[model samples]
Target: MLRLFSVLIAAGLFLACLTGYVLENYTVQQRTYGGAGEHLRGAQPPYPAGGMDNIFWFLQVSDIHISRFVDPQRAPDFQKFCTETIDVIKPEIVLVTGDLTDAKERNRIGSRQYEIEWQTYQTILKKSKVLEKTKWIDIKGNHDTFNIPSLESVNNYYSSAIAHLCGHLHTLGGFMPVLHSRHERGTLELELADWMDNRRYRVLVFDHDLFSFVDLKFDKWPVVVITNPKSALYSSPAHEPLGKIKHSTHIRVLAFSPAQVTSVLIKIDGVTMGSAVHIKGPLHTLPWRAKDYSTGMHYIEVRAQDKAGRTTIIGHKFTMEEVRLLPFDIMASFILRSSHYMTLRVIFILVLLANILVIIAFRYLTRPQLKESPGFFALVNFSFHVFSKTNILYYPVLLFTCYIAVGPWFIGEIVDGHFGACFVFGVVVDGHFLEGSLTFLIGILQLTFFNIPLICYLCWCLLLRCRGAYFRSHIKYTGWSCSVPMHISMLGLLGWQVYACYLLQKTYGTAAFFLSPVRTWSVILALVLVYKAWNLNNSAIRTFKADMKNCPYS
Candidate 1:
């Protein structure tokens, strides 16, 4: 009855979580830039046409990773970037796309946000006066999310923004730009490289209703953005009306250079049109008939050369027709974003189902029989009787396993100056509870992988010391049948332990294997159990041989 109840509970939880995932991901549509009401109402009015008055420029800097413990110079360098580079560019807005601080400790394994790092970041902004010069927008990266219980928490020092920009992977490397499906819905997802090692930042220009951007290195000159007849690859009807692009008169460009304004050359289909004239601050305009190339797709290349002998070329594919992203691109982005959540859900469901099956199978195998047979039934009965006899050592080991399953197995500085528990249910940081599927999975793993094997080993040892003749006869009849499953379970548990140790070593260095009490104790207990099981196995084998010799059937 208890086993049946456990199976039902597992099934219930699985269904509940499955329903929750479906409702959260599918039924409830995520709000876009146009807001939830707009989405529910379907396509609303298209955005206004592009114009010179709508032109503006901004700076996007990501992965600042200011660290006071590891590299002390990081904070100073960031401050210098803000004061020297930001002041000169004088962008209307500065978008900081996360990783405002390196949350790791000196060892780099422990993840906890330090207040000093946040204070240093604030001090830099104030000292540089960048906040007063431009609209500073900052969002939390994965690093910033670490140890953060809630957005309202005092430990969360990030300045909230409308869109979330992450910088956990440092850089996509060769992947460069990974545009998302959200772009189709008028939300641009741009990821910038790290500023810690690579002094990279993006200069994004909003020309009319079009968006054009270019990634620039520190001190790199002639930041160019082609503004007119926007890139067809990025143009979206949700943000801008595609029908109005054909009425554009001149090909406009925004070029920012450290040196004196130089010549801006415009090329269409590899043919140079003419030199663009400087209209205003960083704005260059070249007259071009939009209808001339309105029939098919065309490429626009803008090459800007400064007096400092530095040249930069940027190209974009433009078309007067409607822009549609490839179907594969949209699918790929959706998959990449939701892959982790999907994987966790699948694994959680599988674990629950497997446990239910195992319980049902065990109950069926151990059920009372009207006529007992000397095959698998006798083996099951023999195993059950042996395990039913509990020993004094079992109590302590069972208590230890329970504690490990539920109690604080791993405790560290989860929040600034707040040491919290990282147990089976979840992590508790500064009195806030953060529970997830991963935490529950770990608890299930502890119960199945660690507790079950240890309990079985305890029962096996007790069985070897049993002095009843009937029990000895049953053991002889069962032979290796009962022992094989226990041995297999123990071997599987040991394998899991070794794999876990390797994972810990890989992630947090070799010191973590020994430093983590849960892992260290698990290894020690497994080794001890293996040694005891071996000795008991040999004793059982001797006793079986002796009983067989004395039996009349032999």
Candidate 2:
């Protein structure tokens, strides 16, 4: 029974490894959705009624962050460029989605030149005749609220409120917004009066710091513009609608933002077809196909909006029919063009080689022995030997190994010029960098290899448990109290990290990315240690019970 369970667990792990890692880039499935509700309305582009496919193009300008102080005259040049762009593309709508001006301040509280910066921004929009002629709408971004102390105030307020909720607040005032800072925190809403007749549209501002939707809602106001549906790579659709569309062809869009985008809107011909199918990630992916609609020529339009009411639109004319998949080389070439793909391939190769080396070494060193001993016992014994007082020299070695497993992230940050001596963990961090480096890959492999024996034993345990039987002779119990604190501390640290990363996500977009590998290793290492200690405790208890049988006065 135990053997059967082990086989099942091993099989499951193998399958997961194959599907999730090896074959991940082989093929991507097509996702399509039909006309949905209110969420779709804001995101989908306007449907085009029966018309011949013609060459029409549009322009998109994002993250303009126009600042007067940064470059005094660039604003005018920017306006001139916009004027030229209008003449060139003659876009249907000029969408300006947030960051109209740059605050040009970081960490220096209350020192922003908001008035001059915004004056420059407003002057550019007014001077640009193209903005007047073309339908252009502006959305508020973090920088646009330069004078507002929303981020600092809200962070303090929420932090205090959370502390109070957690039963740590003895004082009543702790629940209120902390006002110790020099500047007063304004209401985090930007009001646009009468852009529409007799109606006011309020653009709620945010710090763009959110890890979960629940945390977003806790802020009591939505902050951020809705973005277009995006792809895994945070890209818009790849296939140009210029040629005939095949049933197997995919229309992919990468629409995601730290500010949080809600829904995807898609349209076919003159009618709203459906919502864009979403694949959520740190960068979300949205995909669709023309086969979801009727065959023949159809106009495909997709729009994505973020929570802050900002919108982006894209459309193409497609001719849909049954067609074979694109050749593998063609797809591979496109995917390989991406730096991330190359990096992942390199890391995979490195890890695979490392594991192969470890396996070969273990096979060569170990002698085959016919035995019926539990693998868990051996793991516990080895761990005790390495960590016990008798092996005091190995303590520093263990610490060094753990540090190596975590050094990659810190080193990567230092190389990127984001490291500061004041960071709590003594690692450099600002949170906007999400991509990993070679060091990160090596660190993960090192950690994985260090714990490979325990990981294997855990897998074996699963197999044994699945078999529903095991030798009673292997059973043992002992005191695990001495090791409990270490295991608990590790687990507690992991939990705190997850929560901290979640809360700090908006401030540092890469918080989760930086912590992910560390958290993974911590989980694996802590769980193995805890399980080993448990077995040790059980065996000790059983040994004590056996020894009692020979008591002189039994």
Candidate 3:
């Protein structure tokens, strides 16, 4: 128990340190969401003083997660921009958007976040020179005002502070109303002014999901006009009827790859009421470190208000697309033109070579002699040597490994880490379960070389039992010959893993499969393994019968 506690403490400290390093080292860049169309000087409205109508540049930044995972650079960039904008432009009013902290903000008191985010906010305020100066205010962004303290609660909590800062609260408070007004019955429900108009121009803060919606403003209470480009978030049928939508049946996108042009179909129980839109370009890929990213909900209901003041709701779903990726040479020559295909190919070759080297090493080093001993014991010993001698000091090392390295890696955070290794694991596991025989030939060389050996070793260890004594005997042939039941159990596990991987590949596409074909092929190869197992089981039974014959039919 003491050893276990020590390990837990050590792991916690390691993770905390890692997270801290990321937060401290990185730099932030100034990013803007609103006030893109026009620019104006600060603390000065587009119009003169004492005018009931006013216009000023405003920025809305939500989900501003300031945590270990958040790029540290973003925080400082925000501070610099705020400082420069405050010192130079000095707008009449400023609204600091919500979601200031990246930490797990279940509680504001004991959670270490108060000091971090509070200080960060204080810096922004000091640098902006707005805290003691202009009409600066804030409202709840998703991160800050979400479930933890509730948007309403946080708004109320910060109300006094914001009121002391500036009069911009009146403008931001109506931002959500402007955003929702486009929806059916989305008329500006706020009993407040929705637009800022002077002799020069008009500015509006619309607060709907920007990707799928339009932006507009005019000199009317409920009557407004949209004059921006089409929003990326909405899903329109490929076959639009004229310029208008005739029958807006719901469409669902099962899968979509913006670059690669791939997608799958989805089946909603009833009529599909929404179409999923996934668009990936150069920007989202850079900072997010995404090869091919995807995010969509199972359900999104559509609704709108008519000219007669009645509201109608509709449902929709549509086909999904898989962003396509190919060798850059192929694309450049035959498709879009050169964009670093050769570089990727070179890297790919290097990785393949590395996997081959590792596989050759593992098969020779770990393969045990074929005798009456367990195979899993050999694997355990091998892993112990590779990872460290820590396992020798404590048995919990194995459990901890499975939990940390395997369990969490498998169940959570599928999007992070060395993706190629994971892809190979998926390929081999999937092939054995679902595809069938001969799929082994399709296994990526890397998966076969690297991942298969690991699967074989893990299976062997899991089946042979947790105790070291269960596998005492070793031989020059099999290395460690596990008993018949143990061997069968290991084989079965490998088969299941293969099946699960194959399914993931089929459903998600072969981004990972191509990365590690060997593992993918092993999964396909699992089918052939069943016959091998049956033959071995029969051999074991036959050998037992022969021994019994000499023992006198008892």
Please give the CA lDDT of all the candidate structures.
0.64, 0.38, 0.32
Tens digits of per-residue lDDT for model 2, 166-185: 11111123232111100011
Candidate 3 weakest ten by summed lDDT? 282-291
Question: In candidate 1, which residue ranges exceed 4 Å CA deviation?
Answer: 1-52, 71-73, 112-116, 140-165, 172-186, 326-336, 351-425, 428-432, 437-520, 538-554
Q: Choose the strongest candidate by lDDT.
A: 1
Evaluate model 1: give its lDDT: 0.64
Candidate order (TM-score): 1, 2, 3
Task: Give the per-residue lDDT digits (tens) of candidate 1, residues 1-554.
Answer: 79669979999998999778645543324232322112221223322232346677889888888887776677888898788778667799888888888888676756777888889999999999998999989887877877676688777777667766654455556353443343335555555677877777888876654677777788777778887767665555565545545666678888887686689999999999999988777888887777798666798998999998889988988776444432225333443445554465556455545544443344345433323223444433444444332233433454565565457655555555566667655777677887655666665676667766665665454434432323234456336776577667777787887777666554445445565556656778767654553344434444333433422321
Error of 3 at 506 (Å): 39
Clashing pairs in 1: none
- Using lDDT as the measure, name the better of candidate 1 and candidate 3: 1
* Residue 278 lDDT (model 1): 86
Residue 186 in candidate 1 has what lDDT? Answer: 51
